[model samples]
Target: MNAVNWGILATGRIAGTFAAALRELPDARLLAVGSRTAESAEAFAGENGAIRAYGGYADLMSDEDVDVIYIATPHPMHHANTIACLEHGKPVLCEKPMAINQREVREMVEVARQRDLFLMEAMWTRCLPVIRRVGEWIEEGKIGEVRMLSAAFGYRTGWDPAGRLLNPGLGGGALLDVGVYPVALAHMVFGGEPTGVDAAAHIGATGVDEQTAMTLTFAGGGLAQLACAVRTNLNQDARIDGTNGHIDIPIFWRASTATLHVEGEAATVINEPSGYHFEAAEVMDCLRAGRRQSSLMPLDETAAIAHTMDRVRSAIGLRYPMDA
Candidate 1:
């Protein structure tokens, strides 16, 4: 099989991590890196071993050899960047919180569908082996009717009004940055939009949420209590409780192991590699199969999760400048 030529559309930290993960895959090649300046693009290219570097996003979009473009820009840039790639007839794997709002996500997905181009939200957690095993266990009735889930992701950070974590203009907030993990996991395990969502947030002086909590109730009476914060250190753990047993997933976002506790049986611990290669491989597989979206992380599910987030924001009155 021919190697997939990957073009990275930003020089941020996440972009570098993804480049490293791509290098670990034999069927992938880092073809190009793009940034707002020639110097930054050249530097990223040098570090990532890319064959070429472009001074601007448009240049990267026009590159003929790039089989897929990874939009690793901040949350607010995802919609516009993904749209540009799809317009150029290039497949895209956009970073998480796919867009600032569900409206933008719908537009991005619509463009990809109209152009018959592959597009996927780069929610690596969905593609990880341990998370997939969680899904499998649920399907096999090992968990026996999952009824509740609890997840929390948080970390204390010093105040920086202009930084990505606190800036309203950058779509900064705990919800979009880290809350999406627990939200998406709930959607993945519960399997639909919540019937009701109740949330509260601590809107900081920067006009962005510093912390948030949510209670989601599914139609089938399943419940999920989730929390995310940028002002406190949280356990960053997750659990799924069922009629028969529960699964404990520590550091659930990028978890490599999970312990299953059956009602009256010895616990089983499952393990896998902790890396982003699985999601990259999934994107390549979709491209090779001529599929427009991943079955594992479908566009509809992405939009649904975004809509749920919009609801949470609405309930908490957390409006970004972009919403104005």
Candidate 2:
């Protein structure tokens, strides 16, 4: 039996979740943790029982014992941080919205290809058992050819204009933050970027979108209506309507469960594991097989989703402060 040594970079809320999930996988070890400040790194490491705490990113990448590094940094920092890890001959699993733009995605993929290291986006929702059931139902023709998809994910976050939610410098806004969930779902289930993009947004004083609504028209005439806002509350349900039947997912973005309702008969429910364990289990399984990337959450899928999201951002005139 082989074990995978994991190094985690970042010390935020999501990073903590990732660390906790990795701890549950016996075949995977939380070998080290890195943060901008050694104090935070030490704190996170102590909390998670990680073996080592690095003062900075370089230390984690150079620690030799780490077989993989999870890049859970902010959206704007993903490309740079991921490249640094790959340069150290470490595989990376970056969190979603891989970057603020497609150009950055290209750069990240380029570095990984150049180094021949495995790289993946932490689009964990796609790999969950519940979402897998949703996809399976579609494949089984439980839902006829997908005709329409609608999803809404939004919450009123009253963060200052310079905070993560409203700041342009932080790649802020509802779109890149919460909206990516709905967008990724549409792309993962429907396949490919939409043919047409139409959008309306409530732009904040900080030049970031506070609320956005978009309609994506696919080549087959199917439509996806996506709405995300930082100014309102939403139920965050996702529904896929087809010619025969429709499947609905509640709390769809982070869905731990889903229901398949066919044209007739009773609806079937699929439940999944808790939190980030689903993705962590996948990482451990891949590591045991000596594989770099998970077959379920490959880097290519992440890049494709990023590309579609790039287009969506353009159609809606959403630009980050880092945009050149």
Candidate 3:
């Protein structure tokens, strides 16, 4: 298998992780890393063996040697960065929460569809093998008719009002950061958008949400109860209950293990690999198959989740600095 020439579009922590892990894949390679500053891009790309360091993102996007561009920029910048990549006719795997708003997501989808380019919101969790196995078990009736889900993700963020967790300008708050994991998890297990949504939040001094709790009622007679907090760390366990049994993912947000407990049977531990490799593998798989979008991370599902999140943001009265 020939390696895909990957490009890292930002010098952030995720960019480094993806670059480092892609090297382990053997069939994937990092060709370039781009940053606003040449020094940072050069340093990052050099550290990861990328042949090119682009001082500007446009240089990376226009580089014919690159196969896919990873958009690791902030949520607020995702709109502009992804559009720039798509406009230049580059395949993109924009980071989680897809974009700062539903409108931004719609535009990204439209451009990609119009250009017939590959694009997906890199919600890496969907690619986890363990998550796939969990889905399999649910489909096989390990848990019949999932009726309820309880999940929470939180962290003691040290309360920096100007930091990404609290800055409205950065599209901060628990909902988009840690909260997205739980919400996405609910969607993954349930396999559809929430028909009803209710949410509440406590806004920080910077006007970003410090903590948020949401209840999403799915059409299939199940409810997902989720909570996220930047003010404190949650135990981060998730549970899915059904008529006859339940599965518990103790480390819900970034799970390494889950146990299924049948009504009259012993709990079974399902261990899984721990890393960002799965998401990269998905990218590799899609590129090799000449896919424009991931069926697992389909655009419609991404849009529905964004729509649900928009409602949650609206109900919490959360407004980012660039919301207009």
Best by TM-score: 1
Compared with the true structure, the alpha-carbon lDDT of candidate 1 equals: 0.94
lDDT by residue (1-324, candidate 2, tens digit) is 466788999999899989888877777789999999999999999999899999999999999889899988879999899999999999888887888887898899889888877887888888788888788888888888999999999999876987877888888888888888898888867877778888888888989888889898898899999999987998799999998889889889788777777777788887877478777767667766767677776667677777777777787788776678
Q: On residues 15-102, what C-alpha lDDT tens digit does candidate 1 reach at each position?
A: 9999999999999999999999999999999998999999999999999999999999999999999999999989999999999999
Instruction: Please provide, for model 3 over 1-324, each residue's C-alpha lDDT reduced to its tens digit, 9 standing for 90 to 100.
Output: 388888889998888887877877878888898899999998897788989999998999999988889999888998899889989988899999898778889998999999899999988877777777787888898888899999998989786777777888899999998788888888888888898989999987888888999999999679999999989888799999988899988776567888998889988899998667778888889989999999778998888788888888998998876678
The RMSD of every model to the true structure, in order and in angstroms, is: 0.8, 1.6, 1.3
* Candidates' C-alpha lDDT: 0.94, 0.84, 0.87
Best candidate, lDDT-wise? 1
How many clashes show up per model? 0, 0, 0
> Which pairs of residues have clashing backbones in candidate 2?
none
Error of 3 at 242 (Å): 0.8
Q: What is candidate 1's CA lDDT for residue 319? A: 85
Best-to-worst ranking by TM-score: 1, 3, 2
Residue 107 CA displacement from its true place in model 3, Å: 1.0
